[model samples]
Target: MNSTAVSVDRNRTLKMIAREFYHGLTSLLFPAICIVCDQRIDEPNTVVCHNCWSDLKVLSTDIVKMKQIPEQLDTILPVFEFNDTIQKIIHGLKYSGYKSSGVHLGRLMAAQLPQDFLLKDTVLMPVPLHPLKKRERGYNQSMYIARGIAEISGNIIRDNVLNRVKNTVTQTHLDAHERHANMQNAFAVNRSCDLSGIYSIVLIDDVFTTGATMNAAATVLKSRGVASIRGLTVAAPI
Candidate 1:
Protein backbone atom coordinates (compact mmCIF):
# COMPACT_ATOMS: atom_id res chain seq x y z
CA MET A 1 0.00 0.00 0.00
CA ASN A 2 1.03 3.57 -0.63
CA SER A 3 2.01 5.90 2.25
CA THR A 4 -1.38 7.64 2.30
CA ALA A 5 -3.21 4.32 2.35
CA VAL A 6 -0.96 3.07 5.14
CA SER A 7 -1.69 6.19 7.19
CA VAL A 8 -5.43 5.78 6.67
CA ASP A 9 -5.24 2.13 7.69
CA ARG A 10 -3.23 3.02 10.75
CA ASN A 11 -5.78 5.67 11.73
CA ARG A 12 -8.66 3.22 11.28
CA THR A 13 -6.91 0.61 13.38
CA LEU A 14 -6.23 3.15 16.12
CA LYS A 15 -9.85 4.26 16.10
CA MET A 16 -11.07 0.70 16.54
CA ILE A 17 -8.66 0.13 19.39
CA ALA A 18 -9.69 3.42 21.01
CA ARG A 19 -13.37 2.58 20.72
CA GLU A 20 -12.81 -0.79 22.39
CA PHE A 21 -10.82 0.84 25.17
CA TYR A 22 -13.48 3.48 25.68
CA HIS A 23 -16.20 0.88 25.90
CA GLY A 24 -14.17 -1.12 28.40
CA LEU A 25 -13.57 1.90 30.58
CA THR A 26 -17.20 2.97 30.44
CA SER A 27 -18.38 -0.56 31.27
CA LEU A 28 -16.54 -0.36 34.56
CA LEU A 29 -17.36 3.29 35.36
CA PHE A 30 -20.99 3.61 34.25
CA PRO A 31 -22.69 0.28 34.44
CA ALA A 32 -25.92 2.07 35.25
CA ILE A 33 -28.75 4.13 33.81
CA CYS A 34 -28.33 7.32 31.77
CA ILE A 35 -28.93 10.63 33.49
CA VAL A 36 -30.96 12.17 30.69
CA CYS A 37 -33.33 9.25 30.49
CA ASP A 38 -34.01 6.04 32.42
CA GLN A 39 -32.52 3.92 29.67
CA ARG A 40 -29.21 2.13 30.34
CA ILE A 41 -26.17 3.88 28.81
CA ASP A 42 -23.74 1.16 29.90
CA GLU A 43 -20.91 3.63 29.26
CA PRO A 44 -19.56 6.68 31.02
CA ASN A 45 -19.57 8.68 27.81
CA THR A 46 -23.30 8.14 27.38
CA VAL A 47 -25.00 10.66 29.61
CA VAL A 48 -28.01 10.75 27.25
CA CYS A 49 -29.74 7.79 25.79
CA HIS A 50 -31.27 7.51 22.32
CA ASN A 51 -34.73 8.13 23.75
CA CYS A 52 -33.63 11.28 25.53
CA TRP A 53 -31.78 12.40 22.43
CA SER A 54 -35.07 12.28 20.57
CA ASP A 55 -36.76 14.10 23.41
CA LEU A 56 -34.28 16.97 23.13
CA LYS A 57 -36.26 19.41 21.03
CA VAL A 58 -33.70 21.47 19.18
CA LEU A 59 -35.78 24.56 18.43
CA SER A 60 -36.14 25.62 14.84
CA THR A 61 -35.10 29.05 13.63
CA ASP A 62 -38.70 29.70 12.64
CA ILE A 63 -39.88 29.13 16.21
CA VAL A 64 -36.89 30.96 17.61
CA LYS A 65 -37.47 33.89 15.30
CA MET A 66 -41.15 34.09 16.10
CA LYS A 67 -40.77 33.70 19.84
CA GLN A 68 -37.44 35.16 20.95
CA ILE A 69 -36.38 38.09 18.74
CA PRO A 70 -38.88 40.81 19.36
CA GLU A 71 -40.04 43.19 16.62
CA GLN A 72 -37.87 45.89 18.15
CA LEU A 73 -34.55 44.01 18.17
CA ASP A 74 -34.52 43.16 14.46
CA THR A 75 -30.92 42.01 14.11
CA ILE A 76 -30.72 38.93 16.28
CA LEU A 77 -31.06 35.17 15.82
CA PRO A 78 -31.55 32.44 18.39
CA VAL A 79 -31.23 28.69 17.74
CA PHE A 80 -33.04 27.24 20.75
CA GLU A 81 -35.48 27.96 23.56
CA PHE A 82 -35.09 28.31 27.31
CA ASN A 83 -37.43 25.36 27.66
CA ASP A 84 -36.78 22.08 29.47
CA THR A 85 -33.89 20.55 27.52
CA ILE A 86 -32.06 23.79 26.87
CA GLN A 87 -32.55 24.95 30.45
CA LYS A 88 -31.00 21.74 31.73
CA ILE A 89 -28.09 21.96 29.32
CA ILE A 90 -27.46 25.63 30.10
CA HIS A 91 -27.74 25.00 33.83
CA GLY A 92 -25.21 22.21 33.52
CA LEU A 93 -22.76 24.46 31.73
CA LYS A 94 -23.25 27.56 33.86
CA TYR A 95 -23.57 25.95 37.31
CA SER A 96 -22.42 22.37 37.01
CA GLY A 97 -19.08 21.03 35.72
CA TYR A 98 -20.26 20.37 32.16
CA LYS A 99 -18.21 22.99 30.36
CA SER A 100 -18.45 21.04 27.15
CA SER A 101 -22.13 21.93 27.00
CA GLY A 102 -21.21 25.56 26.37
CA VAL A 103 -18.97 24.68 23.48
CA HIS A 104 -21.54 22.30 22.07
CA LEU A 105 -24.29 24.90 22.26
CA GLY A 106 -21.94 27.55 20.88
CA ARG A 107 -21.17 25.48 17.83
CA LEU A 108 -24.86 24.90 17.33
CA MET A 109 -25.51 28.63 17.65
CA ALA A 110 -22.72 29.50 15.21
CA ALA A 111 -24.09 27.06 12.66
CA GLN A 112 -27.33 29.02 12.56
CA LEU A 113 -25.65 32.23 11.44
CA PRO A 114 -25.71 32.79 7.70
CA GLN A 115 -22.53 31.78 5.87
CA ASP A 116 -22.09 35.25 4.40
CA PHE A 117 -22.27 36.75 7.88
CA LEU A 118 -18.98 35.05 8.85
CA LEU A 119 -16.66 36.63 6.34
CA LYS A 120 -12.99 37.34 6.97
CA ASP A 121 -13.69 40.82 8.27
CA THR A 122 -16.29 39.79 10.87
CA VAL A 123 -15.35 39.92 14.56
CA LEU A 124 -16.97 37.87 17.32
CA MET A 125 -17.44 39.57 20.68
CA PRO A 126 -18.81 37.89 23.78
CA VAL A 127 -20.47 40.03 26.42
CA PRO A 128 -18.10 40.51 29.29
CA LEU A 129 -18.59 39.18 32.81
CA HIS A 130 -17.66 41.14 35.91
CA PRO A 131 -14.29 40.42 37.58
CA LEU A 132 -16.03 39.14 40.69
CA LYS A 133 -18.17 36.72 38.68
CA LYS A 134 -15.22 35.59 36.61
CA ARG A 135 -13.25 34.85 39.73
CA GLU A 136 -16.19 32.96 41.22
CA ARG A 137 -17.05 30.93 38.10
CA GLY A 138 -13.39 30.41 37.10
CA TYR A 139 -14.44 30.95 33.45
CA ASN A 140 -16.76 33.14 31.46
CA GLN A 141 -19.41 31.04 29.76
CA SER A 142 -20.01 33.65 27.08
CA MET A 143 -16.30 33.74 26.23
CA TYR A 144 -16.27 29.98 25.82
CA ILE A 145 -19.32 30.22 23.53
CA ALA A 146 -17.64 32.97 21.53
CA ARG A 147 -14.48 30.90 21.20
CA GLY A 148 -16.49 27.97 19.89
CA ILE A 149 -18.35 30.20 17.41
CA ALA A 150 -15.06 31.66 16.22
CA GLU A 151 -13.63 28.19 15.68
CA ILE A 152 -16.30 27.34 13.08
CA SER A 153 -17.17 30.80 11.76
CA GLY A 154 -13.50 31.75 11.16
CA ASN A 155 -14.31 35.21 12.52
CA ILE A 156 -11.80 36.96 14.76
CA ILE A 157 -13.03 37.08 18.37
CA ARG A 158 -12.55 40.47 20.06
CA ASP A 159 -12.22 39.40 23.68
CA ASN A 160 -10.97 42.66 25.19
CA VAL A 161 -13.02 45.50 23.75
CA LEU A 162 -15.89 45.40 26.24
CA ASN A 163 -15.55 45.38 30.04
CA ARG A 164 -18.12 44.76 32.75
CA VAL A 165 -18.15 47.41 35.45
CA LYS A 166 -20.47 45.74 37.93
CA ASN A 167 -21.68 42.35 39.02
CA THR A 168 -25.36 42.48 38.15
CA VAL A 169 -28.29 40.32 39.21
CA THR A 170 -29.50 37.37 37.16
CA GLN A 171 -31.45 38.73 34.21
CA THR A 172 -33.55 35.58 33.98
CA HIS A 173 -36.14 36.67 36.52
CA LEU A 174 -36.42 40.23 35.28
CA ASP A 175 -39.18 41.71 33.10
CA ALA A 176 -38.52 43.73 29.94
CA HIS A 177 -38.48 46.97 31.87
CA GLU A 178 -36.49 45.46 34.71
CA ARG A 179 -34.00 43.94 32.28
CA HIS A 180 -33.35 47.30 30.68
CA ALA A 181 -32.98 48.90 34.09
CA ASN A 182 -30.69 46.13 35.29
CA MET A 183 -28.30 46.14 32.33
CA GLN A 184 -28.19 49.89 31.86
CA ASN A 185 -24.72 51.35 32.45
CA ALA A 186 -23.43 47.79 32.97
CA PHE A 187 -21.08 47.54 29.96
CA ALA A 188 -18.53 49.99 28.60
CA VAL A 189 -16.15 49.82 25.68
CA ASN A 190 -12.49 49.99 26.70
CA ARG A 191 -11.57 53.65 26.25
CA SER A 192 -7.88 52.86 26.01
CA CYS A 193 -8.31 50.64 22.95
CA ASP A 194 -9.20 51.78 19.47
CA LEU A 195 -10.95 49.90 16.66
CA SER A 196 -11.65 53.11 14.80
CA GLY A 197 -12.52 51.49 11.45
CA ILE A 198 -13.72 48.02 12.39
CA TYR A 199 -17.43 47.52 11.83
CA SER A 200 -19.08 44.13 11.42
CA ILE A 201 -19.56 42.29 14.71
CA VAL A 202 -21.28 39.04 15.76
CA LEU A 203 -22.24 39.36 19.41
CA ILE A 204 -22.48 35.99 21.13
CA ASP A 205 -24.12 34.90 24.37
CA ASP A 206 -25.88 31.91 25.95
CA VAL A 207 -29.39 33.34 26.14
CA PHE A 208 -31.48 36.27 24.91
CA THR A 209 -34.34 36.79 27.32
CA THR A 210 -35.37 40.45 27.27
CA GLY A 211 -32.59 41.63 24.85
CA ALA A 212 -31.77 44.54 27.16
CA THR A 213 -28.28 43.15 27.73
CA MET A 214 -27.64 42.82 24.00
CA ASN A 215 -29.08 46.25 23.25
CA ALA A 216 -26.79 47.77 25.86
CA ALA A 217 -23.75 46.05 24.34
CA ALA A 218 -24.79 47.00 20.82
CA THR A 219 -25.24 50.62 21.83
CA VAL A 220 -21.65 50.72 23.07
CA LEU A 221 -20.31 49.14 19.89
CA LYS A 222 -22.41 51.38 17.66
CA SER A 223 -21.12 54.45 19.45
CA ARG A 224 -17.59 53.31 18.59
CA GLY A 225 -18.49 53.30 14.83
CA VAL A 226 -19.38 49.66 14.40
CA ALA A 227 -21.34 49.51 11.14
CA SER A 228 -23.20 46.34 12.01
CA ILE A 229 -23.60 44.57 15.33
CA ARG A 230 -25.73 41.44 15.21
CA GLY A 231 -26.57 39.19 18.15
CA LEU A 232 -26.53 35.39 18.22
CA THR A 233 -27.46 33.27 21.20
CA VAL A 234 -28.15 29.62 22.01
CA ALA A 235 -31.54 30.13 23.60
CA ALA A 236 -34.18 32.85 23.91
CA PRO A 237 -36.85 32.91 26.59
CA ILE A 238 -39.75 34.35 24.71
Candidate 2:
Protein backbone atom coordinates (compact mmCIF):
# COMPACT_ATOMS: atom_id res chain seq x y z
CA MET A 1 0.00 0.00 0.00
CA ASN A 2 1.07 3.60 -0.60
CA SER A 3 2.60 5.56 2.30
CA THR A 4 -0.24 8.09 2.15
CA ALA A 5 -2.87 5.36 2.47
CA VAL A 6 -1.05 3.85 5.43
CA SER A 7 -0.87 7.25 7.13
CA VAL A 8 -4.63 7.80 6.67
CA ASP A 9 -5.41 4.39 8.16
CA ARG A 10 -3.22 5.14 11.17
CA ASN A 11 -4.96 8.46 11.75
CA ARG A 12 -8.39 6.78 11.58
CA THR A 13 -7.34 4.18 14.13
CA LEU A 14 -6.03 6.87 16.50
CA LYS A 15 -9.32 8.82 16.24
CA MET A 16 -11.34 5.70 17.03
CA ILE A 17 -9.18 4.98 20.06
CA ALA A 18 -9.50 8.55 21.30
CA ARG A 19 -13.28 8.51 20.98
CA GLU A 20 -13.61 5.26 22.91
CA PHE A 21 -11.28 6.51 25.64
CA TYR A 22 -13.28 9.72 26.01
CA HIS A 23 -16.54 7.83 26.32
CA GLY A 24 -15.02 5.47 28.86
CA LEU A 25 -13.69 8.32 30.96
CA THR A 26 -16.97 10.18 30.78
CA SER A 27 -18.83 7.10 31.88
CA LEU A 28 -16.51 6.62 34.82
CA LEU A 29 -16.88 10.23 35.93
CA PHE A 30 -20.60 10.45 35.30
CA PRO A 31 -22.53 7.27 34.84
CA ALA A 32 -25.28 7.24 32.27
CA ILE A 33 -28.61 7.20 34.06
CA CYS A 34 -32.17 7.15 32.84
CA ILE A 35 -33.65 10.61 33.13
CA VAL A 36 -37.09 9.29 34.07
CA CYS A 37 -36.28 6.50 36.49
CA ASP A 38 -32.77 7.40 37.61
CA GLN A 39 -31.51 3.94 36.76
CA ARG A 40 -28.08 3.08 35.41
CA ILE A 41 -27.86 2.87 31.60
CA ASP A 42 -25.55 0.10 30.44
CA GLU A 43 -26.03 0.59 26.75
CA PRO A 44 -23.79 2.81 24.67
CA ASN A 45 -25.04 6.01 23.00
CA THR A 46 -28.39 5.94 24.82
CA VAL A 47 -29.74 8.52 27.21
CA VAL A 48 -32.67 6.56 28.49
CA CYS A 49 -32.44 2.86 29.27
CA HIS A 50 -34.42 0.14 27.48
CA ASN A 51 -36.93 -0.41 30.27
CA CYS A 52 -37.84 3.27 30.54
CA TRP A 53 -38.03 3.56 26.79
CA SER A 54 -40.43 0.64 26.52
CA ASP A 55 -42.52 2.00 29.38
CA LEU A 56 -43.11 5.31 27.63
CA LYS A 57 -46.74 5.77 26.66
CA VAL A 58 -46.85 6.56 23.02
CA LEU A 59 -49.69 8.40 21.34
CA SER A 60 -52.47 6.36 19.80
CA THR A 61 -52.66 5.68 16.07
CA ASP A 62 -55.51 8.21 15.79
CA ILE A 63 -53.59 11.00 17.49
CA VAL A 64 -54.21 13.35 14.57
CA LYS A 65 -57.96 13.14 14.96
CA MET A 66 -57.84 13.15 18.74
CA LYS A 67 -56.20 16.50 19.40
CA GLN A 68 -57.46 19.92 18.30
CA ILE A 69 -54.59 22.01 16.94
CA PRO A 70 -54.41 25.48 15.48
CA GLU A 71 -56.15 26.37 12.22
CA GLN A 72 -53.03 27.61 10.46
CA LEU A 73 -51.17 24.28 10.53
CA ASP A 74 -52.22 21.49 8.15
CA THR A 75 -51.65 18.79 10.75
CA ILE A 76 -49.71 18.03 13.95
CA LEU A 77 -47.93 14.78 14.73
CA PRO A 78 -46.93 14.03 18.34
CA VAL A 79 -44.95 10.91 19.18
CA PHE A 80 -45.73 10.61 22.87
CA GLU A 81 -48.22 12.04 25.34
CA PHE A 82 -47.04 14.66 27.81
CA ASN A 83 -46.26 12.92 31.09
CA ASP A 84 -43.59 12.71 33.77
CA THR A 85 -41.32 10.56 31.62
CA ILE A 86 -41.56 12.85 28.63
CA GLN A 87 -41.26 15.95 30.76
CA LYS A 88 -37.98 14.82 32.27
CA ILE A 89 -36.55 13.88 28.90
CA ILE A 90 -37.51 17.21 27.38
CA HIS A 91 -36.17 19.11 30.38
CA GLY A 92 -32.86 17.34 30.01
CA LEU A 93 -32.72 18.17 26.32
CA LYS A 94 -33.69 21.82 26.73
CA TYR A 95 -32.18 22.91 30.04
CA SER A 96 -29.54 20.36 31.08
CA GLY A 97 -27.44 20.31 27.91
CA TYR A 98 -28.33 16.72 27.22
CA LYS A 99 -28.47 17.00 23.42
CA SER A 100 -28.22 13.25 22.96
CA SER A 101 -31.68 13.03 24.54
CA GLY A 102 -33.02 15.22 21.79
CA VAL A 103 -31.57 12.96 19.11
CA HIS A 104 -33.02 9.88 20.78
CA LEU A 105 -36.42 11.53 21.06
CA GLY A 106 -36.20 12.67 17.46
CA ARG A 107 -35.58 9.12 16.28
CA LEU A 108 -38.68 8.00 18.14
CA MET A 109 -40.70 10.78 16.58
CA ALA A 110 -39.41 9.88 13.10
CA ALA A 111 -40.54 6.30 13.57
CA GLN A 112 -44.05 7.51 14.33
CA LEU A 113 -44.30 9.35 11.02
CA PRO A 114 -46.20 7.72 8.17
CA GLN A 115 -44.21 5.49 5.83
CA ASP A 116 -44.36 7.99 2.94
CA PHE A 117 -44.67 11.15 4.99
CA LEU A 118 -41.55 12.80 3.58
CA LEU A 119 -42.16 13.57 -0.06
CA LYS A 120 -39.48 13.82 -2.73
CA ASP A 121 -38.87 17.53 -2.19
CA THR A 122 -39.91 17.99 1.41
CA VAL A 123 -37.88 20.18 3.76
CA LEU A 124 -37.57 19.98 7.55
CA MET A 125 -37.44 23.41 9.17
CA PRO A 126 -36.94 23.66 12.92
CA VAL A 127 -38.52 26.45 14.94
CA PRO A 128 -35.98 29.24 15.21
CA LEU A 129 -34.63 30.62 18.47
CA HIS A 130 -33.87 34.29 18.83
CA PRO A 131 -30.23 35.23 18.49
CA LEU A 132 -29.86 36.22 22.13
CA LYS A 133 -31.53 33.10 23.48
CA LYS A 134 -29.58 30.86 21.12
CA ARG A 135 -26.33 32.41 22.26
CA GLU A 136 -27.32 31.92 25.86
CA ARG A 137 -28.20 28.28 25.33
CA GLY A 138 -25.17 27.65 23.12
CA TYR A 139 -27.33 25.52 20.84
CA ASN A 140 -30.84 25.33 19.47
CA GLN A 141 -32.63 22.28 20.90
CA SER A 142 -35.08 22.16 18.03
CA MET A 143 -32.25 22.03 15.51
CA TYR A 144 -30.79 18.98 17.23
CA ILE A 145 -34.16 17.30 17.11
CA ALA A 146 -34.53 18.19 13.44
CA ARG A 147 -31.11 16.69 12.75
CA GLY A 148 -32.18 13.43 14.35
CA ILE A 149 -35.35 13.36 12.27
CA ALA A 150 -33.40 14.04 9.11
CA GLU A 151 -30.91 11.33 10.01
CA ILE A 152 -33.66 8.71 10.24
CA SER A 153 -36.01 9.85 7.46
CA GLY A 154 -33.32 10.68 4.88
CA ASN A 155 -34.86 14.17 4.51
CA ILE A 156 -33.10 17.52 4.26
CA ILE A 157 -33.00 20.08 7.07
CA ARG A 158 -32.94 23.74 6.02
CA ASP A 159 -32.08 25.58 9.23
CA ASN A 160 -31.59 28.93 7.52
CA VAL A 161 -34.93 29.07 5.73
CA LEU A 162 -36.53 30.95 8.60
CA ASN A 163 -35.27 33.43 11.19
CA ARG A 164 -36.72 34.48 14.52
CA VAL A 165 -37.06 38.21 14.18
CA LYS A 166 -38.71 38.74 17.55
CA ASN A 167 -37.34 37.71 20.91
CA THR A 168 -40.59 36.77 22.51
CA VAL A 169 -41.02 35.96 26.16
CA THR A 170 -41.29 32.41 27.38
CA GLN A 171 -44.77 30.91 26.94
CA THR A 172 -44.60 28.52 29.85
CA HIS A 173 -46.82 30.66 32.11
CA LEU A 174 -49.07 31.96 29.37
CA ASP A 175 -52.50 30.73 28.39
CA ALA A 176 -53.41 29.70 24.88
CA HIS A 177 -54.65 33.13 23.89
CA GLU A 178 -51.63 34.75 25.46
CA ARG A 179 -49.30 32.41 23.60
CA HIS A 180 -50.99 33.38 20.33
CA ALA A 181 -50.48 37.05 21.12
CA ASN A 182 -46.84 36.53 22.10
CA MET A 183 -45.84 34.72 18.88
CA GLN A 184 -47.38 37.24 16.50
CA ASN A 185 -44.94 38.23 13.71
CA ALA A 186 -42.18 36.34 15.47
CA PHE A 187 -40.74 34.64 12.36
CA ALA A 188 -39.72 35.72 8.86
CA VAL A 189 -38.38 33.92 5.84
CA ASN A 190 -34.71 34.42 5.03
CA ARG A 191 -34.23 36.72 2.04
CA SER A 192 -31.44 34.55 0.64
CA CYS A 193 -33.40 31.30 0.86
CA ASP A 194 -34.84 30.14 -2.43
CA LEU A 195 -38.08 28.25 -1.93
CA SER A 196 -38.74 27.62 -5.61
CA GLY A 197 -37.91 23.93 -5.52
CA ILE A 198 -39.16 23.15 -2.03
CA TYR A 199 -42.48 21.31 -2.35
CA SER A 200 -43.40 21.08 1.35
CA ILE A 201 -42.12 22.06 4.82
CA VAL A 202 -42.39 20.26 8.13
CA LEU A 203 -42.00 22.49 11.18
CA ILE A 204 -40.24 20.72 14.07
CA ASP A 205 -40.23 21.56 17.76
CA ASP A 206 -39.59 19.77 21.08
CA VAL A 207 -43.01 20.14 22.72
CA PHE A 208 -46.44 21.37 21.65
CA THR A 209 -48.63 23.09 24.19
CA THR A 210 -50.71 25.78 22.44
CA GLY A 211 -49.40 25.32 18.87
CA ALA A 212 -48.81 29.08 18.62
CA THR A 213 -45.10 28.88 17.72
CA MET A 214 -45.59 26.33 14.96
CA ASN A 215 -48.59 28.19 13.52
CA ALA A 216 -46.72 31.49 13.45
CA ALA A 217 -43.81 29.83 11.59
CA ALA A 218 -46.20 28.26 9.11
CA THR A 219 -47.84 31.62 8.47
CA VAL A 220 -44.49 33.09 7.49
CA LEU A 221 -43.79 30.20 5.12
CA LYS A 222 -47.24 30.51 3.57
CA SER A 223 -46.73 34.19 2.92
CA ARG A 224 -43.48 33.28 1.18
CA GLY A 225 -45.52 31.07 -1.28
CA VAL A 226 -44.97 27.72 0.36
CA ALA A 227 -48.07 25.58 -0.26
CA SER A 228 -47.98 22.94 2.47
CA ILE A 229 -46.83 23.03 6.11
CA ARG A 230 -46.99 20.30 8.73
CA GLY A 231 -45.96 20.23 12.41
CA LEU A 232 -44.05 17.60 14.36
CA THR A 233 -43.31 17.54 18.07
CA VAL A 234 -41.89 14.98 20.47
CA ALA A 235 -44.75 15.21 22.97
CA ALA A 236 -48.01 17.08 23.58
CA PRO A 237 -50.59 17.37 26.30
CA ILE A 238 -53.78 15.44 25.55
| Runs of candidate 1 exceeding 4 Å displacement | 1-27, 31-35, 38-74
lDDT for 27 (candidate 1): 75
What is the per-residue lDDT of model 1 for residues 63-174, given as tens digits with 9 covering 90 to 100?
Answer: 7656554332347877666677677667767776567657756776677667676779978888888989888888888887877787787778888899888678987677
Evaluated with lDDT, which candidate comes out highest?
2
Give Cα-based local distance difference scores for all models. Answer: 0.74, 0.87
Task: Please write out the lDDT profile of model 2 over residues 96-207, one tens digit for every residue.
Answer: 8989888877887888788877776789998989999999999999988998888899889999889999999989999999999999999999999889877699999988
| Model 2 Cα shift for residue 215 (angstroms) | 0.6
Model 2, global lDDT = 0.87
* TM-score between candidate 1 and the true structure: 0.77
